[model samples]
Target chain A: MPVFDQGYRRFEGTLRPRHALGALVWTAVRPRLRWWLWLLAAILSFYPGLVYAAITFITLAVGPDAFGGRNRLPEASGAFVAFSDNGDPSQLVAELLAPTTAGIVARLWRISEQCALAGFVLPAVACAGVIATDRATGAHQIYFARPVTRMRYLLSRIAAVTVFCSVATVLPPLLVWLETAALHDDPWFAAQTWSAPFAIALSGAVYAYFVSGVVLALSSTLRRPLVVGLATIFSYLFLQVVSAMIVHGLEDKRWRALDPQYALGGITAPLYGVALPDWLQTPWPWLVGLVVPTLLLAYVWSRLRAVEVAT
Target chain B: MTSTAPVVRVTALEKRFGAVRALRGLDAAFPRGAVGLLGPNGAGKSTLLKVLLGLLEPDRGDAEVLGLRVAADPMAVRRAVGYMPEVDAYVSGLTGAASVRLAGILCGLPGRAAQQRAHEILYYVGLGEARYRRVEEYSTGMRQRLRFAQALVHDPELIFLDEPTNGLDPDGRDEMLALVDDLARHHGKSIVLCSHLLHDVEAVCEHVVVLREGTVALSGSVDDVRKLERGTFHVRVSGDEARFRAAAEAAGMHFAAQDGETLVVRVPDGAGAREIFRAAHAAGCVVRRLATVEQSLEGVFLRAVEGAAEARA
Candidate 1:
């Protein structure tokens, strides 16, 4: 019951609109930074990259001799000891480079996709309680009580999840790609696989944006974080199952786009020069991958605006 | 902002939630200093607060906060006013400091400044030591203080406190009322205190506005509202009660109500203590206590509400 009768002191400092968004994003993400679930998700996200790095190191150590003969070994890789001394060393450089380079790029694409899948845990954890907890605690009313607009609040939530996703999904694969390039020590291999990191980054970003958008959109509609988290995870599995049943029942592969993850892979695989699996191949992935997230995000914006005004 | 000028003004404010009219052509001007907003359930006190904060747009009419039209520039109005909502609301996982800082930031304070003010305001509201604890851990009183801290963190020109003393014990309620009074009287902050507790409002507010059925039932300074009737006094006497009653009635005085050993009598205009003393002497009773009884806020509220109902009917 102590009284603060020093009288109120007016604040003369000016407000910065730019700081508002950053403050909101920071506050939204700060609590989860120390949570064990987020840490576990971060580790899982990098697990694929770690596995890919190990594979690249082993392949580089075994050298072109593992592919066939000494003649198949690139000259640039002669720094390593030869496994076979009796074989002719006159094979074309393309002969030594094509299969191994193709194999490495393919492996990187697979790992990138794996990283995206594992990184689902990041958005699941990051966005689970963001809007749901706010709604439950009535924090959204406090936010709307201030000068904050509905659009700014929605943007901050999406940005926080996107940032978490980038760190968890995009950074690890790029690091793995850098490690792959460094271990090979062959200029020809580096030249052929230079765009692998970009592809990994691009596909990882696409995955992050898509999953974060869908999960956050779900979070906006619910009031319990645990329910939102479970629902988000369930949605992926449900989409996969329902899409597979439809694809098989009608004997049409085009409907595979209904499975967001499959559609995402179809869209991202081309960046690594890999096509969708023969049976699942279709032209719908590009449309589905790009359109679904956009629609969900638009829905989230509308929902937030309604909640702000109605409540 | 002069003392006489209004901190908030609404004209022909009409709001409808489907078929139910929450506010029907409500008009009010809340002056500077402490003003009490008193209303019962579904009286539109909460609706008016929301509209002033720009959280909800009125279906029709003009509203202004700190002279800025809410509809034309709600952000500017929000920048200058702070609100302590009636409902319990706080960021679940955030510490008290973080919650207040977030509010300050949303109101447009720079990050560092918001952080600084968060600490100062929490300490001001007596939560200095508990600033680091998560809001979920706070008690009812502490959470109320936290809400006040967040509302004051930005130091806006006007503050809207809805049911500020809703669940506090006597001591806590006294402390809150003292703080509110100090803010209005000493610190020069305009306050709109909405509460069902008439005593709390009477203790802290200078001006009062009572709402009924989404419209203003009564609005004026507390003194003026209570001063509606004069020459009414509470008289206490120790003598034969039958003789005393006869004597008072004979003196053109009518008993409006009575308490144990005390009589509340309404004296006719131009009547004074002389008439009451004469009546008591004639009754062979000693005048023990005689004092004018100012109408309580409850009386004003009931009269206003019931009067409005009768007029409408």
Candidate 2:
């Protein structure tokens, strides 16, 4: 028999009080935050500043007469410059821009909602494969062999997607809302628009949870990230198309409740203190809207259970 | 080491998966140093490892590792133990260094500490040159070394190495075995090595746990397990065969000389054949050849498992 010797030394180092969730968060975000995302952030950060600049130019150059007759901003940019300033210049520009609390709330909702949707797409792609890739690569063995539970594992992933998506969804609208508030000379800006930030926050959070649940659940079933990302886009588009056809061709407004996009919009109306449309006032739309996503999330939980088996 | 209880103890452990009972009232103990877990397919080797790692729950009874109750604090049990599974795995999109570093970090090391340890362990496992390469691009041997590196990165107190030499050439297999030996002997890390290869177990392990039908059929030091009974031998001779047989019979030796000029004799262990030689020499017979027949580990293993089946039948 040969004497066995490989010179493996015992390490005398100490293990730190680890932050597992924090480490996972760093890994998920660091790789996806490329130059393209930075460029997007720069644009979002300055858009409100650009809006303030545009408002200043219009208010000073065209004077209050530009707001003389129109209750809304110019529908098209080309016609915006040539509209004759013939009406009497009696009202202030700010006064015509936001005449009441309802009017300003509606504008904030529309802007935040639009930014939220745009922000949702890129981050969704980033998070689409987080759970799926882990299972596909058998990396869960490395994780579960440590001191982590399944719940913590799932939460860290969800939190990662939420934080990533917020970069696009949550941050932009609040910055724009702040700039809009600061530009207003009206004293009612503070009193009337106080709920605007909170509403946008609530809307972004709901959007994050819903999207993360659906995308990650899909992720658990598949081994490929490409499939998961494509599925996410397809599911959203398919739901919209189905609901649109029913609402347009069949003349049945209740089917709109099943539309994820429409449901999200209606769900945010109460947060912004806007009333639901007459067609969406019934509970069927809300019921299917909430139930379908919940069922999808349940499917995710079940799929995660299967994915947890390391072998 | 014998006076104290084993480092791991499973008492009356029972685990059932659907209609299959993977473990049935199983009981075993493992002391420190290199121990081999031997069992045939579906004999509960995988399930036992998972239970000890706190990855699966048993139906009844309990297990203890490193003096901690596994049920009370499974995460703590896992924290102290390193595990190398049979599955081929890599962290997607990560280099070898990053994957090992993440394993350390997930096992509770700080990020910087984990990274430093990763560099050290990669070199230790002979993966230094391939540390920067993407894990998915690694060859079979390199990936095997990477798995070993990940298990060693945390410097765990005890490690479970499952099928460590599953798919390797002779040289690769020998190198892997030597590394395990060093961990057990030099570093003093307690090891539970699971493999289907009997020679691999015999080469390194001092203790053996032979599991059959979800229960331990044989458990002891390998030294005791491999001992032969009565030291049987075969001797070939020619001159004065009748006189030698009479003399051997009178000397109270059990001999059967009718198997074609060969006498099969039983003697005490390590005493050699002094009585037979003396009888043959006194009877004017010259001894031609004498050889000791030792029992093999395979015989012991087959009897252990097959014996269990016989008893069941």
Candidate 3:
């Protein structure tokens, strides 16, 4: 037998018990992440706040009369009464708060629009390669060969994507809500709708589920990261656009069943107290919303095995 | 060394891939030090390794590695042992040291300890400078050594090296075999080298377990396993070969093979060439050449596996 002097010393340190799973969360993911994705998340985190800031400026500018002053700024028409009203600024502010149902829907729609925009794009992009790359490059063998189980492996991988997506989707809206409340002097609205924080958290959770569920399922099925990412983003946008077009063209609430956006909006709209027209309140959208994530989760359950097919 | 239990004691181990049976009642006990696991392609060697590592659940039976029952406490087995897989497997976009250190931490080492060990083990495997580079940029030999380093970074008591020299050249292959030998002897590590190359096994292994059709066909210490029949010698002679054979038989010598002027003859265990020389002299045949030919590992392996197949049939 051939022998060479290695001069290697034995490791005389104590090993922690059953720490492989925790270590996986720390070191399982390769640190060389796409910098652009994080940049996008950071950029997305500013969206709700930016929109709120812009709207706050606009509301303040358009309704300067509401601050116990006369309309000294600009003149407006019948629809712009909040701005054109030359009455007591306090009365004008209360009048704006108790606007018609259509007015509430229009304002709530704008918030939903921003949330939907970030929620759809951020989750799809951030969670694209959670498991796909592991399968692609045969890293699962490296993990499984350690003291980790399939469940721990899957959870960590999901957590890697889920946490990042939550940063982009959940945490931002929460911050934006705080910023909006702190800046706004609307006590009546705050009393009636103190659940804004909880609603943002719930909506953020919905977005995270879409990411961890559908995107993760797609990741498990494929071997290429780029392909998984594109597939996720494309599917999210495609289904949202197609369902919206079909529902609008038909002018039928029944056709809205296919729209995941509609379902998310339905759940989101109630939190904001947007009075939904009875024709637009279809449970199919909600059911589809739940079913899609459930099916994707089930797909992941059946697919991600220990001895995965070699790369 | 104080532990008397076998390094690995597997009984009736069975694993299946859907309808196809991968391991069918494989029973073998691997001992300490370098033990080679030899098998043909698809003979369930990889499956056995995965099962022992707890990467896959066995369909039936029990297995214990390093005195830890795999079925009952697989994490303990994984904690005590390390594995270098057969395929190209690594977390992409990681430097060799970073990858090895991550493997160490995941195997239960603290970060600082894992980092120190990673550097030491990488240096020990002759990749001290190369460890700074991403694994994707490594040569085949470097990747093999890197994987070996990862397996050692945690100071595991036992390691499973699967196809360690798969894509190496002759010199690299020699280097890998030498490393295996050094690790087993100097480092006091027990290793299971999974390879299809018999020469590699013969070079590094003190004991061997051969698998065929998911069962142990032959297993023993390398010396006994490859031992030739006693006093067997192949003699190539020029004059009166038949007369030489008859004379050899008359002298109570048994001939093993005949091909042209070449003759295989076996004397008693302790008997030497004196008997064959005397018989050749009596026959008046010129003994052109005579030498003992030891049975090679390839011969032993082919015979064992073929014999098992015949018995199964």
Candidate 4:
């Protein structure tokens, strides 16, 4: 055997593989924490309070009779009146708050989901930036020159970025929950009222994961993180707008399933007392919809895995 | 020195980038010493380093590092050899210590040990004070040192430093050179010093491989490769010019020129000094001084590169 071979074997025998997953996650998450913390603070300070304030203001201004009562408008008018027939003011209050609160929560959830979608752009750009910076600063050579292979290095980066996206997606819902608990007194608030928030949070997490995968894929192909980020955002917005236009223009009931907003509407129809079609009711569409984006992201990751550090 | 096989050996290694032939049938060996890879830009120095590291696939031929074939077992080779690349590259947002630790871990060191080794190696490379600082904040010299630290952290037997002193100041350059010397001499590490600076190479390297246009133009020990050309001498004499010239001519010595009280002469190789002394004494010339001129590495490198260029032309 060659001298280096003997030396390497001896060294390998002595050395242990360092599994610093926590350290890696910490390193990846720490930088983005400041931004997320500020976001969490903002969400906590404004969102739940905004919901409570909007509910309180609407209750005072419009009263409980506007929804369903003797005072209900046969001809819709800009008038506020209290009804004598409903009997239960609390139920009326809940009814008054439900749509507005759900609307606010759903909107907030959509915003979070959109942000999660926006986040998909980030990991790709972030990973690409990390790789590109490594190349620019000669770190890629330094890192690759060590015992680490390109695949391991790339995987570590993806892992780190995935952790970062997860934290970003999860933190907002957590802040909203804590804030709601601190502010609200409704017995149904925790059990019944939180379903929308939970769904929004769950969907956001899934979306974030999907986005991270897609971004990692983009990062592998493109060297410039900014280009990847901008391209991703543009592509997503373009797809959303075009898909919406096609769905709305065709008015084909089958194509409605393809529209994400419509799909979401279909999912939430029970809350609005609308009957969903049998095809939309089945689990297959949601499963297929979720799986398609995931598969595309996996395809992206496979492509990224093939990208060699050009430096 | 230990009767072990060569650490690295390359036979007719060739690489091409599409139409651009980067390495053309280059044969070389990196033995157990501080070996210098001297070449100008585009001379395949970087390509050769990458090939040795098993980072790039060779278009033809084969290379073995630490007994691991470059094509067949690159990971094995990488685990055995540490490389400092020619260009500036690093992991962003990581502290200098973190970067080194990451490299150490990838080299298979456990967490605590990797951290400890990272600190020690960084200190060795003069990055002790800056260990906690992010790599983005490091100066060019610090970055270079960190690069060296990463290479050494794995405790690899052979280290490849590509233009290790590129952006350093004079003091930094000297320190880097001293560190490289210490690594080779004291730590028993074999090094491949890839640099365009002939002076830096001469300062630390005992053997050198000079590449010209992707081929080995010359390769040998530093001393042997810089052998002085015959017929050059440094002479000092106090005598009449005419008698001195006549005496030198009569003795079959070629007189080149006179400078002040000295005469430059072309003495035959292996000629005894006593012959010149006697000839000068007979001619009533006082021989003040006599010495032989040695060739500089710069001269040898220039000649080798020029010769290769001429050969190709």
The residue-by-residue lDDT of candidate 4 on B50-148, one tens digit each, is 777776889899998877888997766777778787667677778999989877776677777788888778777777788999998999998888888
Second chain alone, TM-score for each candidate: 0.80, 0.79, 0.80, 0.79
Residue A168's lDDT within candidate 3 is 59
Global lDDT scores for all candidate models = 0.79, 0.73, 0.72, 0.64
How should the candidates be ordered by TM-score, best one leading? 1, 3, 2, 4
In the order shown, what is each candidate's alpha-carbon RMSD? 7.6, 7.9, 6.5, 9.9
- Against the true structure, whose DockQ is highest? 1
Error of 3 at B206 (Å): 1.5
Q: lDDT per residue, candidate 1, A202-283, as tens digits?
A: 8877887788677888898887888887888788888879988998899887777788766777778788887566655666
> What TM-score against the true chain A does chain A of each candidate get?
0.78, 0.77, 0.71, 0.57
lDDT of 4 by residue, A79-165 (tens): 111111233334334434454455435433433433444344445444445444444455555555555555566556666666545
Candidate 2 overall lDDT versus native? 0.73
For this target, which candidate reaches the highest TM-score against the unseen true structure? 1
Write candidate 3's Cα lDDT for A1-311 as tens digits. 13134566899998775555555655434452578867886676555545544544455445544434333322221222211224333333332434433343334333433455456566566556567666766677777787776778777866666566666556655664555455556645545546666666666666566667767888888777677878877887777688778867987656655655556655556665655556557776566667678788877876866344331
lDDT of 3 by residue, B1-313 (tens): 3555679989999988888888999899999999999987777888898788776779899999988888888888888898888777877778999889888887889989999999888888888878789888998788888888888888988999998999989988898888888889888899999998999999999999989888888889998887744477778776787798899898888765555767777787678888888888999987888887677787667655655566669
Q: Which of the predicted structures, 1 or 3, would earn the higher DockQ when compared with the native?
A: 1
Give the per-residue Cα lDDT of candidate 2 at A309: 51
Candidate 3 residue pairs that clash? none
* Residue A48 local lDDT, model 4: 34
Off by over 4 Å in 2: A1-19, A31-96, A99-105, A115-120, A181-195, A284-291, A309-311, B1-4, B228-296, B308-313
